[model samples]
Target: MNAPPAGLEIRPLTIPRTIDDPDAADFIAMTHVRNLVYAETSGHDDGRMAPAELLPNYAPDPAEIRYSWLVLLDGEPVGRVGVDVPQEAGSRVVFWLVELRRSVWGRGVGTAAYALVESTARAHGRTVLQTWAEHPPSPGDRLEPPTGFGSIPLDHIARFLQHRGHQLEQVERISALDLRDGLPRVRELCARATEAAVGYRAVQWRLPTPPEFVDGYAWMKSRMNTDAPAAGLEFDEEVWDAARVARADAKIVDAGRTALVTAAQHTETGELVAFNELVINNDLTEATSQYDTLVLSSHRGHKLGMLVKCVGLLAWLDIAPESPRVLTYNAEENRPMLDINEAIGFEPIGYEGAWKKVLSDPTTAGADTADSSDSSGS
Candidate 1:
């Protein structure tokens, strides 16, 4: 095995209750690095979030076990590691990431950090490890997954993953819509979708979900794991109830972020068959993020997906008037959703690869680590 860099130390991260807490110093530094890494890789600051706006996501939760570490070189923070294990019964899936600054590339920092991620998953009996990374356009060889809908440059990040036994299972398109261009096309699409969705109507609300819609919303959230196109990646079928829904809402609100949920309800049965989410940071001038958008399998063919997305974007304009743009992601194979996005003026901004590795033996994790001078940004 290759030796890790000298003076490199991986220490557990402490999530403070608030930004004002005395123990928040490390958290704040980590948040800054996180934002910097994202901006450096994506060429935009849309993913930036204040420490107060990011702490709630790292808070303790019952449905999943999360482990994080700060990678320090000579006692100075340089990178971060994360591993997430779902609480679902018989779940063997573990999601992880090892993000470092470009300046730290070729020093074996990422490889060393990845060792920790692998060990954590092994300890938790998770054999299926998965991760996603943004690969900005680069001129070089390209790699395509089995789905054949998108490709990513076989650059530093790809080589690192390939050397460590990970396979590229899928590619996702990162898309954005300029709110400055106005929502005329979106409005037109919404009208057509509304006419096509004969028996469904759009219902909208802000985060502490209304009492009447809580159960339906929870049901759709659970379906997100099963209904989405995951290619070869594995996702636990999440269990969501009113309590879980409340916890999720609290996380967003506590982070000083606002979430708007737009769902399509069946008129006769009063079931929320489809839904979309739009979230904005405390500063509305920044870009808005389009979160989960899903329509139940049984409710397909009614144009509900387009209905919810168009309705959500239109409503979001009024909610975040100053927000510059809206960002979103979709599996390349999800053409129906992509069609809607394209029709409404959302263009492809970037692409990301979804990678997976199945450990044949827990004890042998990262034993064949590959030597690469590449940085994996968050």
Candidate 2:
């Protein structure tokens, strides 16, 4: 895809995280605007990570989230994005997240960059690419999202995804796990477990995911992924086990994000039932540090979720005691999980909607032709 007219130039942008600025005011102003944009669009203002985290992600064994971009003309940064593509052993599909600057609406930056993402997928011969998003603000919604967390709407971004033949297949809610007051007792944490009668057990899988278990982990992912709540699911739903998990690790570290934390549970039958993850610095959106969590259906009855979650919760909190929260998203309709959330004091912040388009390439589907032949032609 080519750039549209009006003196627009779309070039991949880069920044060095190691450098510091002498213009404290401009630096702070840029950050403030950046933050303002964030609160307006995504709903949170990440004031941490000093203004320098906005650089090329190139660290070894990186955090869980990663960023890459394309800058527009006029230099104020029209559109840039962060992607999390780590290869973890037990995962099935490759995932990505793209955040755009709203100023460039109607511009081609999104279309072009989306094309690039497609090109990369083609290069790898991958089956699907997954993205997570929130519902858009309402008609009379204010510019600033409230202090809590919520789903960003899919209205605006959906147009782009729909234009590309993407459709919403599922929706998940994002929730935060904060340990600001320190973790509750282990017994208190264990009270939520559903494992006793089911013979299921949960435990935190430590960093440096053990190599011997990779293949089996990859095997289960295909059957494991629940549907995405929004459109544009681009990965194959296949059995995942160890190899998939390994890919997640390599993908993140390769992109300068870390995949250092995880928790999982197994039945006495040795079936992998539940899981959640805590990233050291993969995501930098919340003013305080945060992490992501995942739970599977097979493990739902066992209270393994709370059990598995608490491990990673206390784990990250133990390491970065200064951090405020660990973030996770559950489907808005997911009430059982919400029960566990309320017990832990995770508050609501913002809300996002999920949408999907079932049709693609409308022209390919055969459009009705307009009658251009006028009687005057006779």
Candidate 3:
């Protein structure tokens, strides 16, 4: 193994009550580094979030046990590490990430940071470890997953994962839509989808979901884990109820972000069968992010996915006109969803690799680790 950089230390991150708390300095600094690393990798600031906008995500939650650490190099914050263990019964999956600045690449910082991630998972009794990393377009040989829907450059990040025994299980496409182009196409698509969805109608609302729709929305949200294309990665079927839905909404509102949910309801039954989400930062200038978009399996073949997405985008235009673009991600193998995105002017911006590693023996994992120079930012 390569020698770790001098003065390297990974310390637990303290979750403050608010961004203004005195203990929030490290968290705030880590947030800045996170944004900088994202901008460096994506070549844009669309993913940037203010310190206040990111604080809520780090706060304690009941659904998952989250562990975070601040990577310090000679007492200066240089990177961040995170591990999340789901609370579902009998779950063994753990998701993790190690993100460092470009200047720290080629050093052993990422490898050392990942050591903490692996140890935390083992301590939590997790056997399946998964992580997602954006592999920006680079001139080099490419790696493709079994799905064969997309490929990522066999860059430094890829080499790092391969060295650590992680397999590239899936590829996700990062897409963007320019809202500045106006919403005429979205309107057209919404109309056509509405026509095709003969028995459904669009229902829209802001955060703090309406009482009548809460149960249905929660049910659909839970289905996202089971219905989405996950390839070889493991996912615990999440259990979401009204309480969980409320907590999720509160988190977004507390973060000073705005979320608009659009769903397609079966008019006759009044059941929410499909849904899409659009979220914008406190700063309206930042790009809007398209969150989970799912349609129930029983409700497929009715153009509900397109209906919800189109309806959501159209509503977003009125909600955050200052936001210039909308960003989204979809599994490469999800051809139906991709077709809708492509037809609606959402262009491919980048690709992300979903990697997985199953530990046969936690005590013996990573015994042959090597140094790698890569930024694992998802």
lDDT of each: 0.90, 0.47, 0.89
List, residue by residue over 55-112, the lDDT tens digit for candidate 2.
3233333223343454444655554443444444333333543445565655555555
Question: Which consecutive 10 residues in model 2 have the weakest lDDT in total?
Answer: 369-378
Off by over 4 Å in 2: 1-5, 12-40, 46-69, 81-99, 106-172, 185-187, 194-198, 226-235, 239-243, 252-267, 282-299, 358-378
- Model 3: how far residue 22 lies from native, Å: 1.0
Model 1 agreement with the true structure over 1-378: per-residue lDDT tens digits: 346889998889888888999999888988888888888889999999999999999878899999988888888788788899989999999989888888787788888888888899889888999999999889989999998879999998998888889999999999999999679988899999999999999999999899999999999999998999999999998999999999999999988898999999999999999999999999989999999999999999999989999999888888899999999999999999998899989999999999999999876655756886544644
Against the true structure, what is each candidate's TM-score?
Answer: 0.98, 0.61, 0.98
Worst 10 residues of 3 by lDDT: 368-377
Ranking by lDDT: 1, 3, 2
lDDT of 3 by residue, 244-352 (tens): 9988998899888999999999999999999999999998878999999999999999999999999888878778988999999999999999999999999999889
- List where candidate 1 sits over 4 angstroms from the true fold: 374-377
Pull out the clashing pairs in model 1. Answer: none
Superposed Cα deviation of residue 212, candidate 3 (Å) = 1.0
